[model samples]
Target chain A: MKIGQFEKINDFEWRLPRETQPGMRVPVVVFASERMLNEALQDRSLEQAANAAALPGLRGNVCVMPDVHQGYGFPIGGVAAADYETGVISPGAIGYDINCGVRLLCSTLPLQDVKTAITDFTAALYHACPSGVGGRGIVALKARELKAVCEQGSGWALKNGYATAGDIETTEDSGCMEGADMEAVSSRALERGVDQAGSLGAGNHFIEIDLVAEVFDSAAALAMGIHQGNLALQIHSGSRGFGHQICTDFVQKFQTVARKYQIDLPDRELVCAPLKSPEGQQYLAAMRCAANYAFCNRQLLGHSARMVFERFFPGAHLLNVYDLAHNIGKIESHQFGGEKINVCVHRKGATRAFGPDHPALPARFQKTGQPVLVPGSMGTESWVLAGTAAAMEKSCGSCSHGAGRVLSRTQAKHQIRGDELRSRLMAEGIYVQAGSLGGLAEEAPQAYKDINAVIACIEGAGLGRRIARLTPLAVIKG
Target chain B: MDANRPFSGFAEVPHTADIALDVFAPNLEELFINAAKGLYHILGIRKGTKEVENIHISMVAEDREGLMVSLLNELLFHAANNQAGEFISLEINEYQLEADLLMLEKTGQQKEVKAATFNDLVIVQDAEGFHTRIVFDV
Candidate 1:
C-alpha cells in the first residue's frame, strides 16, 4: 500500500540510504529527472540498485544512470565500483550480453541520397547481414583462430582482413582487452561463438541506416567527424551465445568459490570473489575473452556494414565514428576522496563516458572526451554524446546507454500491429527489413522514452554532452 | 487428441480465478500458456485471496523473442519487487506471441513476490539442463 522511500538529493540525483535495506555497504545514487524517476520507480530497478549496494566490497556508491531499469542481478543502467582486492564480480553485473554494445559509422553519403534507395539498401543489408534465430554469419574460425579473436578482439578482425585500422582506433580499448585466456573459456562457449562470430542475434539488435538529424555541440560533433545529414550506419549486438555461456559458467563457478571464501552475499546471483583471488581472476579472464569476442563481433559487423555500403556507393568512404560497450566491468583507477583507488567498475546497460584528458581515450580525441554513441531503437532517433568532466569526476565516467525502454515488448506488440507499423515506417519514408512483423511491432518507436529527452537529461545531468542526432532512413533488424 | 491439442509446451495459459493447466497440441498455444503460467506461478494467484492493492502491469516485446524477454521481465518483477501489494494473479486481457501482452489484475493476499533469478529457472531439454539469464524489464 505504501511506496518505497527514496530521498531527493538534488534536481538530478536521488539517494537510497543504506539503512533502508539490510546489508547495504553504501548508499545508492540515482541520476534521473523527476519525470524519469516516476517512470523508473514503476519497476524494481531502484530496489535492485539498493540491493547491489549491499554487495560486499562495494565502494563509493551504487550508481544508477538516468536510463535505469530492472535487469537480472544488477539493474540495467546500474554502475557499481567494487574493491579490486576484496570485492566480488557478478556475471549479472556484466550481463549475459557481454559487451552488448553500439557502433556508429559515418559515411560520405547524404540522407537524401540514401533515402531514395531505402528499400534496396535495406534489402541489401538484410541479405548481407545474417540475423534472427540461428543467425549464421559469413565468418568462421577454428579453435586456435577463435582464441586469437579472444585475445586480439577488433584487432584480430583487422589483421584477418575483416576490418580496417580506422575501425580499431574508434573502438573502446581499441577493440581488445588483454589477458584473455582461451583455456578459461568453455568449449561450448567457444563453439557457440565460432560460427556466430559476425552474426547479429535477435532481440533489439539491429543494423540501421541513419542520417545525422540534429547537432547540439558543433565543436564536439566536428571532433567526432559527424555532420548534420551525413548518413551513418549503427550496429547493435554483442558476443551472442558465447557471451551468454561465459556468464552462465562464471556465475555458477563464482557462486561455488564465493561460498568457499565465506563471502557473505545478500543475493546469490551477486556471487563474486576478490578481484585478486583465483576465482576473480578466472572470471576477469573469461569475461575478457567474452568482451573481446564482442569487440570482434562488432568489428566484423562493421566490416559487413562497409561491404553493404560499398555495394550501394562504390569507392565511398565509411569510417567508424566510435564503438562503445554498455555492459562490462573493468579495472580502472579513480580518485575517490583524493586518493586513487583501483576499482572494478561494473557498468551494466551503461556506457563508459570517460572525459577528455583521460589517458584511456584515443590520443587524438583525448581532449574531446570519449565518444559516447547512444543507439535508439529501430525507427527512432539516436544521439552522439561526448563524455563530461563531471562524469569522470563523479560517476566513474559513465552515462546512460540509450533511451530506456518505456513500454514492455508485450505491450508494444499488443498495442501495435506489425503490418500497421510497417506501413507507418513506410509513411515516414523509412524502409524496414524485419524478420517478423510481430517483432517489428514490439520494437515500435513508441516503446521507448524520447531520445531527445533522454539525451537532454544526460547533458543536463552533466554526465555527457550531445554532439549529433541520428535519424533512421532504413533499418534491418533480427 | 488432435495434433494441436497440448499447445507447444513452452508456456502456460491464463485461467479464470485460479491458475489452470491447458493441454494444447501445439507449441504456440503452449508458449502462450507458458507465459501465463510463468506469471501465475510467480504470483501464486488465487481467487480466494483478498485484493489488497491494485497494480497495473504492461509489457512490450519487439517480437516473439522480445516477448519471451518481456515475459521473463514480468516474472522478475513479481519475484524481486512485488512487495507493494499481494500476489493477485495475472489476468491475460490480451496475449499474442511476438506481439504484445496485457494483464489486468489486482494485488492478492500473498505477502511476498520473490525475485526470480536465473538460477531459479531450470531449462531441461533431453534430460540436460542449460542455464540462462533473462532480461525482463519491459
Candidate 2:
C-alpha cells in the first residue's frame, strides 16, 4: 500500500505480485507515470484492484488503467478477465450502471457559425435531451415495445426512427447484445426503464459539443469522420434506474448465492456466482437487458442532438463516429498465458480497445483501430484514441475511460460557486447549461486529474495511441 | 416535528463519487430511523403540505447490515417512485424491521439517491449504541 511497494515494469507500468494478498489468484498490473502512481498510492484503489485479483478463477493479470480511482470493491478503471467455464461473474465487477458508455457524433457545422448563438444552442440542446431531478424521458415504451427494446437494442431505435443504419454500423456490438432475456428482468426494473429512455441521468453525465482541437493520427481521425475545427457531440449516460435496480437486485441476491456456493469474499460487494451456474445465467441475461436498453438510450440521445444541429445549420449532417461501453462485462477471446482462451472481461470505467487486426473491427477501421473516446471534464481537452494490440497483449484489450475524479463532490462544491464556475467557463468560450447549479459545481474541472497526463500514460505504455484531441464549445449537464 | 426532543443522529461521511452516512442511535430501531432521516437530509428534501399517507413496510435480513441496506433502499425506491416522506413508528426485533412510512404526493427533492451499496459496509455495536457506514450510489 505504498508507492515504494509496487515493482516497476517500465517507465509507465507497475505491478503488485499475487503474494501481496492472502487470497489473490493473480498479480495486479497498473499503467501510470511515477507521479500518477504517487496519486494512486494516496488512495485505496490499488488495494481494491488487488482484492479484485482474489476473485475466483481469475485469468491473466488484473490491469488498472491510468485514470483508476477508488470505487465499490473494484477500482473504476480496472479490467479483469476470468475463465468463462470456471470464473465467477459478479455484478459489482461490472458496476451499478450497466453498459454506462460514451457516444461520439460529428457535425458539419463550423465552430465560428455557432459562436454568437452558443447560449441558445446549449439551452436548445438541453431541452432536446431531458435531464436533472424532475427531468422525464423523450421516449415512453409500452409493455410489448419494452420487451422488443430489451431484445433488439438499437435495432429498436432504428425501427422507431431514432437511429439510422449508419449509426448502427458504427456502434459497438452493432448496438445490440445477444443473450438478453426480458423474462429474467424484474417488473420493477421494466417499469422504471419504460419512462426514462433517452434521459441524461445526474452525476457525471452530460451532452458536450466539442471542437476537434488537433489530430495526432490523420488516418484514424478520418476513419472516424472527425475533422479538425468542426463541431462534434459526446453523450455520456447509461441505462438510468433500469440498470441500477438490476445491479441492486442481483448484488443483494448474490450475497446469499455466494454463501450457497461456499465462495469466500473479502467484501460483500464482490459477491458472485460461477459462470455456468443458474444464478450467473439469470444475472447475465438481466444484465444484457440493461445493456441493450442503454444502447437504445444513447441512440435516441444522438437523434435528439442530430435534430438540434440540423435546425441550426440547414443540411448539417451529424453522423455517428462510434459508441463504446466502459462499465460492462463482455465474453471475449484473448491470448493469455501462452494460449487463446475465452473469458468474461469486466471493464468498470475502462473501454474495449481491440487492435486493427481483430475481426470485430468494422471494415472502415481495419487499418486504423477501434476508436476510444475519452471525454475530459468540462473546459478540458477530451481525447480520441485507437486500440493497440499492445492492449490486447497486456490488458485484455482495454484502456482508460476518462479523466477520473480526484476530489469528493462535497469538497468540489466547497471549492467554488456554481455561478462563478459558469462565468469562468463562459470566459473561456465554453457555453454551459445545467439543470442544477449545485450539481454543476460538483463537476468542476478542478475535481478531476489532468487528462493529458492520463493520455500520455496510455500512449507511453503502448496500450492506446492518440488519434485526435477535442476542446469543449458547449456543455449540457444534469 | 418532535416538540419535546431534539433531532440528534447521523452525520455525513465523505465519499469520492457517491453519498455516504455514518449513523448512530441508542438502539437498533432508532438507528434504522436515523439512517432514513440522514438519507432524506442528504437529498435536501422540502416536504409538501398534503396529507400524509401511512405506508406499511416489513422485511427480514440475515444480519444488521443487511437489514440496514434493505431499509434504506426501500426509502430510496419510494423516492424514485415519486413518494415523498417522513417515516414513523419504526420497530425492530432480531434483524426484522416493521414501520409505517408517512409518504406525501408532493415534495421537492433536490438530489436523486440511486441505490444503497454494500461497499466497505459494516454495522457494529458499541457501548453508546449501534454504528454503521452506508454508501449510496448517487
* Model 2 lDDT, residue A206, Cα: 91
Candidate 1: residue A29 Cα off by (Å): 0.9
Per-prediction TM-score of chain B?
A: 0.36, 0.88
The TM-score of predicted model 1 comes to 0.80
Residue lDDT tens for model 2, A415-453: 978999999998988889887888889899998899999
Best-performing candidate as measured by TM-score: 2
Per-candidate interface DockQ score:
0.06, 0.62
lDDT of 1 by residue, A1-478 (tens): 0124678877788778888887889988878877888878876667778778877788788888887766655788899998887777777777877898999999877767656676787788888888874446768888888889999999888888998877888899999998998878887678677788898876678898888888887777777888787888899988887887787667656656777888766655677777888778888999999999999998888898788888888877788899989989999988788888889999998999999898888876787899998887678888888898999777989998987777765567679998999999889878888876866876788877777777767877799987788888888877
Model 2, DockQ value?
0.62
- Tens-place lDDT per residue, model 1, B17-121, is 111122222333344445445555434444333433455555442233333434443443333222223323333323443322333333432212222244223
Q: lDDT for each of the candidates?
A: 0.72, 0.88
Name every residue pair that clashes in candidate 2.
Answer: none
lDDT of 1 at A429: 79
Evaluate model 1: give its lDDT: 0.72
